[model samples]
Target: MELRDYLRILHRNWILILALTVLGGAGAYGYSLLQTPTYEASTQLYVSVRSESSGVSELAQGTNFARQAVVSFVDVVDSALVLDRVIDDLNLNESAQQLAKTIDASSPTNSVIISIKASNPNAEMAASIANSVGTNFANVVVNQLEKPDGNAASLVKVETIEPALVPTSPAAPHTAVNIVLGIILGLGLGLGFAVLRSILDTRIHSLHDIEAATDSPVLGGIALDPDAKKRPLIVHADPRNPRAESFRSLRTNLQFIDVDGASRSFVVSSAGPGEGKSTTTANLAIALAETGARVALVDGDLRLPRVADYMGIEGGVGLTDVLIGRAELVDVLQPWGTGRLFVLPSGRTPPNPSELLGSQAMQRTLEALAEAFDYVLVDAPPLLLVTDAAVVSRFTSGVLMVAASGTTKKPQLTAAVEKLNAIGSRLFGVIVTMLPAKGPDSYGYGAYSYSVQEESVSPSGRGERRARRSKTEET
Candidate 1:
């Protein structure tokens, strides 16, 4: 993924990331509160080599010997020999090995000073332990290690420089530092989880995702409205809504899909059901009619037709009736709004919808409707659900695939495209529906001008046009 993609994921899941970060900080702070307060105290000891010689060369050799001995002396501070003596003197319940864990020793290179530090729950005890450990370690180095033969006076002597003082603050529970580390750790985990979720998510939520799944240019995206179910026919029910504007945008984009004029006759389909194929078809027809163009909206989905219900027109006798010669096109074609747009509702639910849609009579019906109307939009069944759409697509200009954002899966879309390819159906651009109004893939206002002249077809004029159309069909 590119930087933008990572940034998008972070932006999309910022709430989760922030919540986890705070939770981590809270957890660390609570853990620190439960921990015992440990205070640290340190004491310094200066090691020196005593000699009878007063010459400068002899004094330099004594100082060099003290420096070399300090290295070994620092290690002995944490040993059992030194810690056991300190534990006995302080009456500490801990053993020499356990007491050593609380003590640390270090000496600066080329220096004769050895520093011993001890930590404990009690501030006074910590200081006493440090002072006692330093004194015991010094005595052991001078009286024991220096006089290994126990025959003569020892040359090494150690003295105290800085005595340990009682500490007022804790050393282990660094609250501020722990919180910072907790935040850092939380952010890492949150980011890792976000990337994993994005990778595992197979839903098609953006135009780029749809394009990646199929070689189809996205014509337009419809903003998702929570109240869409209450107002499915948005173009007519709520014309000023942003969603209605999107339908108009889709209409405009569909007209200019290619360099030349876009194809007028195409079946709107989806990979699966409930992807807004019917709703898109209804709105697009209304948008086209708003431009003073004669549009024929056909309910091509015979088994489960929605165009008649969405248009509020009679569906007792329409497309199926015309195809079976039971009714003429003009008799059943209903006009909607104050325009030339006509609705060819699916007359009745036929058992063999797929067979009827692919029949020669259905092709002739579509061809005649194509000649009669400037645009013919067929609301067909889902490609994955049934073969009706795939069969009907062969007779139309192309198939306009609709994919619901965050709902449609990539595999379903790919399979739909493959189905179209196998049937040699022209995969006319995609239409992304239910896109969020906010987020990375957001809907925006259009800047380009469209030729939407306000030319309303009067009721009387529509009647005359219907009469003329009927006479022509008869002739």
Candidate 2:
């Protein structure tokens, strides 16, 4: 995917990311509060070798020997030998081996100085341990390691350079650092989860998914309405509503479908059931009739017809009666809403809907309706569930695939397109229904003024009023 795709994923899951980050920081702070606070103290020791006869050469050799010995003495500072003396002097409860775990020793390069650090729960105890360890280490190196004979004085000396002081604050359980690290860890995990979900999820969320899956242009997006089932005929019920306006916009886009103006009939179908194909067809027909166009809305689904129910018309005898010679086409077609729009309901549930719809009699009926009406819209069944839509498409100009946003999967949409392609049916365009009104994947409709003017004035009257206003300004 591109960078914008990743950015969109991040925008969509921003709440989850923020919640995880805050949780991580809070957890780190709580953990820090429960941990024991440790205080650290450090002391430095200076090592020097005694010179003979105050000669420059002897002094240089002694200094070099001391620098080399100090490096090794740093390691011995944290050993059991030095820690044992430190424990004895300070009356520590732990053994030398255990006490050594809290001690650290190091020396700078080419330097005769050794640094020792010790940590404990008590600040005073930590300082005492550091000081005691330095003192005992110096004594051991002078009397035992560097002493030449039993009666002679030691030739090397170790002096305390910087004594350890009691620390005012804890050295471990860094609250601020821990919280920052926790937040960073949480942010990484959140982004990983968001990206993975975006990659794995196949649901159609926006026009981008439709464009990616097929080459057909999206006619328009219908805003989701919770009470859509109650008022299926939105264009007639609420003409000024935004969702109703969307159908009008879809009606405007539909006009440009057949540039040559050869065929006006279209089959509306979806991948599976409950994708708003019937409602879209019914509302679109009403929207077209608003322009004073003669529209014929046919309930083509013989299996389970819904246009009749949604249009509030009688469905006892309609398309099936005409196809079986029981009724004429002009007799079953019912006018709706005192407009030029007509509704042809599915007469009865037939066992062989495919065979009946694909018959030449159904073709002749659609051809006669197309000749009479300005626009003929047939609401067919789902393409995947049956071949009725594909068969109907052969008689119409093209098929309009209506897919539900966030409900129809990409694979399902592709398979539906494939079914149309297999029968060489023209996929005119796509219409996405149930689109959200907000967020990154929302379908945005431009604001339109619906308020009617309270008064009317002609152009000559307005010009005379402007002339009078100019004369008054001159006075």
Candidate 3:
């Protein structure tokens, strides 16, 4: 989409580019080794016209005739007239027609000099062929085209000027040059393939893609953790890990979404399932609770409840029972850990989940919960699957769509945002989750100020550091 995006694609596929370049060079080297080495030898001959007249005009005419005759001699060298005698003198293995392929003849521009070049597998054989072809061409020019000295005035005379030299090395199989060309071709193909993949892939992998499609600001980014399935609540499982630090970063960014406090009561939903929506929601509540704020994480997904399991809390009864008047709101609100965070599981699956989520009772319960706690984070169902989240958003502040990096498609995420907008519900912002653990998308920035004191350094060089939570944006 931009120069930085293309640069990132190249950075990600650098290995592929390097491997293809090496393979191309190797292929070129192997092809060179298999080719037959060829040796070339060249010779030069001078053509002249003799005149008996002592006048300057006659001398000029003779030189002009010789220059015109040189062109005809060049073409005649490849003909059978000269080639037959060359083959007879040198005893070549090829026929006259076949020998033409190995021979090259040409004359310099506005000059009476003809050059003969021959190529062969043997250096000595190539030199002999060039000399033989030149000598035969001279004989053809003197006898067939010009009169003898006794018969009439001799018009043309041809003589060998530079003899052919034995070649010391092969002219073909330029290994280094071939290898360079191969490298160029390989890099071209690699770049083309990288660009093609980036264009064809519709999946979202960065905060830029989300921001380009929606009006919402990018609130935070979560690094991809392959082992997240084993332990969904990473903030509670490993408090000092980098993945947990990402959640805290998200918690900090959430406060700055809107100065009017609309983000405190928003549903976390994705374009589809398996995008770490529940895990992000659970971790955000934990991070918020760490700030001394009372947070209630509700499993609003009647079909697939995960907040209770992720938090390791009771899931037998939750928001559903309270909405149906079967259980009291105070009785079902369960406190977690040593902080003020609470978990409200999605009691049981209901056949009509949409109708119940949009009921008047659901609105009253959400409002009551909102007033009771500082933040009410509802882990609603995916927006694409059902209208429950869209319906529930009317009761809460808005929706915070979490798009999974490298998995959620851009069009799918766009449709989800449009669904909320079509219903006149506000989308708080977007959270890009499960991005690569490194690069620009990672959640380690200068804004997160943390360090260790030099005096606290341990003997093994490991020290206990402290991080001061950011209360507001830097000026």
Compose the digit string of candidate 1's lDDT tens values, residues 83-181.
889888989898998998898888887999988899999999999999999888888987888875757878998999999999988898999999988
Q: Comparing candidate 2 with candidate 3, which one achieves the higher lDDT?
A: 2
User: Which has the better lDDT: candidate 1, or candidate 2?
Assistant: 2
Candidate 2 structure quality by residue, lDDT tens digits, 109-139: 9999889999999999999989999999998
- Model 2, residue 465: distance off in Å is 21
Residue pairs with clashing backbones, model 3: none
**lDDT over C-alpha atoms for residue 350 of model 3:** 79
Off by over 4 Å in 2: 259-261, 449-475
Off by over 4 Å in 3: 146-150, 259-263, 440-443, 446-475
Please report, in order, the local distance difference test score of every candidate based on alpha carbons.
0.86, 0.90, 0.86
For each candidate in turn, give its C-alpha RMSD to the true structure in angstroms: 9.1, 6.1, 4.4
Q: Model 3: how far is 248 from its true place, Å?
A: 1.2
Clashing pairs in 2: none
Structure candidate 1, residue pairs in collision: none
Scored by TM-score, the top model is 2
TM-scores of all predicted structures: 0.89, 0.91, 0.89
